[model samples]
Target: MKIVVGSKNPAKIRAVKDVFNECKVSSKDVPSDVSNQPYSDQETRQGAINRAKACIGIGEIESFGIGLEGGVMYIGKQLYLCNWGALVTPDEKIYTASGARIPLPKSISDELQLGKELGDVIDVFTKKKDVRQNEGTIGIFTNALVTRQEMFSHVVRLLKGQWEFAYKN
Candidate 1:
């Protein structure tokens, strides 16, 4: 099986590869068609869905399209990081799952409030360039206990489980 990921970001691509070990995975750059910094769970999930749907049928090959998007959510008075993944199967079946959430420090939340992408803000705050390409925010917060790729991989597995369950029952 061939899997097409909506974004060429390393973390997203790696997550798909980790979860779909038996498949041939490839990635393409696609627009999420959402805000650079999605600020709500609904918007984040929509971004992933849009990307996955947009990438479907591209290259004229049979493939499953996957999209991964990370954003922030505000709950009560605290801000948290959220990630979502969407999968579009060859038969047009759609499945989605969410990754873990981590509360953001006030300093980072302040920067995000000014309309900055989480990746960029994280890069600046962590003093690391393109952290998303490496360990990512999850790695930083968890002290490498959980990486961004790992988080997304879990979501992909959850989506696959949903698909499997639906097909079996």
Candidate 2:
């Protein structure tokens, strides 16, 4: 089986590989077709779905396409980080899942309110470069208990379950 991921980000690619074992995995840069910083669950899911569909069948390879997107949402007057993953199978079926979420500190939320991507804001706030390619905000917040790759991996696992259930029924 061949799997194509929307982004070349190592974390996302690694998550896919971990969940979809024994598959030929490759990545392509594709547009999310949404705001760089999505502020709602609907937008975040849409971005993931868009990327997954956009990369389908690229290079004339019959492949499953995966898209992973991280964003923030405002719930109960608190801002929380959210991660979403999407899978597009060769049979034209789409599945999606979400990872764990935690409220961001007020300081980071303030910066995000100014229209900054979470990665950039996290990089500046954490005083670390390229955090997205590494542990990510989840890692920083959870003290490495749960990393970006792990978060996406969790979602991918759920997506796989969904696929199994759908086909089983």
Candidate 3:
């Protein structure tokens, strides 16, 4: 079976591979740009949609395209949250995961509103640079030993479900 993944991000790629591996299906990565816009939830979903659309342009190939986009949100007055969006090809299906809505300290969250991403704020808190790519939330902060891959594993599992029917010939 053939699959095209949208980005070159190691974590994103790894998660995709883990899912296919679980289902005993194989895939490939075809680099493409997905939107970074944080509009509405649908916009986030569209980011993934565009990638799957882009990959289909490759032509005459039997495969699926996958796209992933992640973002953050503030809920009520006390909670901060993150989400990951995924898209699968041809059928243009979508799946999303609602991440932990851990409330940021006011000082840190206020900084985020000024345009900094959560990783930057997290870096400042941990006194490290780009921990999101390295140790993720688990490595640099708190006693929680969860890497980004671990957090997104559920997303991976969902993708595996798609491969079943697709790979069945």
Candidate 4:
């Protein structure tokens, strides 16, 4: 099978590729210039659906569209980042994850209103580099308890279904 992934982010693409490789399916990166608007949880799902629809409208070549939309959620007095993701294939089958939550302080939320993501703020506070892409805030602040690769793999495994089924050709 040939799959077309929708995002250009290396981590996400890599996750999809890893699963495909194990499944003996080929894959390719085909970034969609979509704005990735995620107003509501349902709309976030629509964003993924839109990407898949767009990819299919473009051509036919065993395709899958993957999209990650980050959003803010309030729990009590704290704010958190929700990294929701979805995978849509031409089969119309969809795989989605609600994403992990990254709790943030009120001060951080105030700073984010000025236009900065959690990673940027974390980097500023910790003096780290591309903290979101690599270690991520959780990984770095948690003493490397979980690397970004590990997290990505975990989520990918969750979204990709059974590990044994995916890996066994």
Best by TM-score: 2
Using TM-score as the yardstick, the better of models 2 and 3 is: 2
1 or 4: which has the higher TM-score?
1
lDDT of 3 by residue, 48-107 (tens): 555555655354355566665555555666534444545465555544343333445777
- Give the Å error, residue 29, model 1: 0.5
TM-score, per-candidate, Cα-based: 0.96, 0.97, 0.69, 0.69
lDDT by candidate, in order shown: 0.90, 0.92, 0.55, 0.57
Clash count, predicted structure 3 = 0
For candidate 1, give the lDDT of residue 161: 90
Decreasing TM-score order of the candidates: 2, 1, 3, 4
Per-residue CA lDDT of model 4 for 1-169, tens digit only, reads 4455555555656666676674433234444333332334556555554544455423455655555544555677676655555666666666776556667666767877676666667788778777766776557645788655555555566666632344465
Please give, for residues 1-169, the per-residue lDDT of candidate 2 as tens digits. Answer: 7889999899999999998888888999999999999999999999999999988888646898889999999999999999998999887799998899999999999999888889999999889998998999999999999999999999999988998799899
For residues 1-169, could you state the per-residue lDDT of candidate 1 as single tens digits? 7889999899889988998989888888999999998999999999999888877888756888899999999899999999998998878889999999999999989988887888998899899999988888888999999999999999999887997798899
What does candidate 2 score on TM? 0.97
The residue ranges of model 4 lying beyond 4 angstroms of the native Cα positions read 23-60, 162-169
Locate the minimum summed-lDDT window of 10 residues in model 3.
Answer: 23-32
After superposition, which runs of candidate 2 have C-alpha atoms over 4 Å from their true positions?
A: none
124 Cα displacement, candidate 2 (Å)? 0.9
